[model samples]
Target: MGTTVETGPFGHLAEDLADLQLPTTDAEEWRYSRVADIDPTRFARAPVEPALESISTARATIDDLLGASTQPPSATVVVVDGSVSAAEAADPVRIDVHAVQTVQTEQASPNAFALLNERLCSAQVTVTVDAQARVVAPIVVASVVTTDGVVVAPRMRIELGANSEATLVEVHRSTGPSDSLVVPVTEVEVGRDATLRHVLIQDVSVRSDVVGSVTARVEASGTYDTWIAAIGGRYARTRVDCQLLGRGADARLVSLYAGGGDQMRDLRTFQDHLARDTTSELVFKGAVDGRAHAVYTGLIRIHPDARGANAEQSNRIMTLSDDAWAESVPNLEIENNDVRCAHASTVGPVDADQRFYLETRGVPTEVAERLIVAGFFDEVLDRCPVPGIAEAIRPTLAELMSGDRT
Candidate 1:
């Protein structure tokens, strides 16, 4: 591999640990999140782990990890202990999945976790779809960290050429003692008139913590949509940035997260429109029960030169216990005229009126609250980019709601 292990801006930033050090609540981004729970220095100062030959000594199939799906995947890739262990591509002619030594450099950003991933990541996954070729089967990528006290950083890139179409599903899971950490970065590029559907599901052990981010750039007439489902982890966080850089480009982001016990679910998103006639929409919802916590912040930015851009964003979170807490912030930054933009956000408990109505109709209070929580999530679940994700998570959500309201 000709790739420079740590020669880019990331390496430089990694050396300067000033702002990248463990953040405090004084920082705006770490306000709602439990900054005290994460000890960045512990993971950052550990010895750099070498690339793994295999992530796990014992491997499990996709179905065993994530239940059966209505749409069987056409291609599959597995990354364990931070290494790409197995890869299968149904049609190698059009879809190229391989490992390379070199990667193009990226612009500098304030995302500390992203820079950390670049600085330490030894495993990289790349996918390229040939121009004008449509892949009907979906692609599945599963990543796992099965060791204790090990920090895993994985990097990935997905490229779709003009007129090509495909779907990708990313699954992240972990087993073993919860004294582990994972930070993943995925960059996506959609070419002219191409279409890409992406979904991410994170279900690590509740004792583990994960911080990840994704960035996507869409070209002229391209359509890129994404959905995320986050359920388990001690402190799980994900950030997304989607840029519409060409005319007629369209992108949508829909996400869901649920937390129970002492877990934390943190998510942030940005939709940037850089061209005229481009459109973007985002919807995110979540629930926190027991002593759990959840946070969401989203922003839509329309550049001055981006005339006729349309943007919409919505975020809501529900708290099921008195000790459970949630925070939501949705904002819009517009520099263009004659453009459409809107944002809405809310954080609260189950509607009292709705609950009262259900109780009057002979429904138990606990059951009524469960139904309301289920309904709150269905709005976004039904609009997910993929078809089978909602069904696969239904049982999990139901169990979470019915098991322990406290």
Candidate 2:
């Protein structure tokens, strides 16, 4: 498995990553984020296993965070330090769970950090659903990293068969010192006429560093919808690449992010269209307060043959403090003329008119600000594929927003 001549899917990936340097802020994709916190060469390749006592405590913490009782998942896969602790699939939902040595990936990431993960990860969890099967309850996958001064890379692959439908709830959390790095890559393949709903919750602690990516390929008449609710981590960055590769495919991405108290939140997105009659839309709304920073860069590219493609990208951020900063860029490269496209970005303080109107109604200044911030995130929260995700985010958002929601 260590050599470049192995005949496997992930074979030669390490060789391809050999001699690659870590990306600095000078690179276009890494322009505004701090990557040093999670650099692979700066930390030990092997992570110290989390203690059983600590793991028991962490599992209890996760159960409370996800409200496992109310939103009881049909299947649950628990991953700790790059290994799966448990994979549970209930009755009536036909699904296959397995383990693999190395995963061959067709989507290559531009960042060396991701390749470093592929080179270092030890295990992965693979989930597959049969054709035409509908799994009503969601599948919950939790990833946790517990030791400091080390690297943990977790791999996940999801395969949905033709005309199948399901939902996945992914939670990433960490409890470590400042130098801990958790790099997790997830690959999803959606089959023809299938529907997949994905909800990603990044709820790490304030001292963890995370560089994560989700790559998905959608087939004809398939629908892939995703929503992200990020609230924790000291320096965090996530990327999403959606490839609409078949006719009548649709993809939608909606996210809500917040960074406070010197924390930094960065996100990158790409929507590449390769087939006709494909549609894609992305809406990201966030806030930065207490001298924090947030950065967003997105690209929408329509191939020459995708003449009937339609795509839109919108990113809006509210800077609640004078010390807060935000940067956003939306780009598009179209080789075809018969397509619909729109891109919008904004970073500013609360709207004067809205704030003033609330204050005119006798609302206090702090309360008015909270109300406005809550309203701004509501537009996308209303569209979350899993209602429980929005409910789960309220407490964190409220705490970060200064008692905004119940």
Candidate 3:
């Protein structure tokens, strides 16, 4: 990458890496996070190599997790240990087949993972979806770890055609009993009057740290719905930024996170109103236990031209254990006079009165806690427009709430 282009794509990334200053837990934004503990030199780069040897092996694992059958692609973008293959094209779809790879790139921020990604990421890819065409089945973007001390950086860019639509499912896993880092950045552009629905299910693991972010731009009259459910990862943070660039654009951001066993998950969402009559809403629910912690920050910004815009955001968190922790912050910046905006946040333990009521109703303590937690998330899960996702999430939710199943 040229100096100008590199600086243009990632402005602060270059400067931060050059300074090599570790981010502290003191910064308000970084208070709950610290990356210096992870020795940077201990993580070796894993390169993207040929997939001929692991093609069958990779497909088997995918089938086992997804519980479905599929045909093997003619080709793939393979990253073996922290490097990119000379024979592989950065763009996977152009190969006329399914591509698999691991990569990393510099992000435009000083956030712990983003800064780490700047210096450690070796290979990256950008996936593009053409206009007007539709992809029926779920397109799986798999990132599998090979070595224990290996770190991988993978980037995916998805573009939807003027009226095209598709479903993408991203799976991140490690091949061995090593501490792996996977940083995935996804950029999506929804066309005018188009509809895009994205479902992000994170099962990376409590031992892994997954920093995934996506920036989406919606055209006039377009609709975008995002569903994010996180149940694993030692420290997983997802940032979803959506810009309503055209009039009547709409976006719905919903997230459900369960942090257990000392794990922490942080989420930040931004909704930008650039056009008139645009609308957006954000709803997040979290459950924490076993000394786990969860952080949520949301923002809604309306520009002057975004008159008649309507926005509403709310976050509610439930603490399942005495040691668990939760924090929620929602901010709204309005520049237009003819707009409606509101935000609300709450963080606390399950009500004793409600718990006692459930216990008196012949429900065991464990079952009562599960019921309360289920009800807490059910309000948002019920809104999941996709039919099977809600039912599919019930068992996972039960596992976290009951602490019995994995």
RMSD of each: 4.4, 4.9, 6.1
- What tens-digit string does per-residue lDDT give for candidate 3 at 95-130? 122233323323234455555554554544444555
- Which lDDT values do the candidates have, in the order given? 0.76, 0.78, 0.66
Per-model TM values vs. the true structure: 0.87, 0.89, 0.80
Which is the leading candidate under TM-score?
Answer: 2
Candidate 1 residue 238 C-alpha distance from true site, Å: 0.5
Give residue 207's error in model 2 in angstroms.
Answer: 0.8
* CA lDDT for candidate 1: 0.76
Candidate 2 deviant stretches above 4 angstroms: 1-20, 45-49, 90-107, 175-179, 402-406
- Candidate 1 segments whose C-alpha is farther than 4 A from its true place: 1-22, 40-61, 65-67, 92-108, 402-406
Clashes in predicted model 3 = 17
Top-scoring candidate (lDDT): 2
| lDDT tens per residue, model 2, 207-312 | 7777888888999999989888877777788899999999989999999999888788999999989899999999999998887899999999999989899999
**Backbone-clash count (model 1):** 2
Candidate 3's TM-score = 0.80
Residue pairs that clash (backbone atoms under 3 angstroms), model 1 = 55-80, 290-406
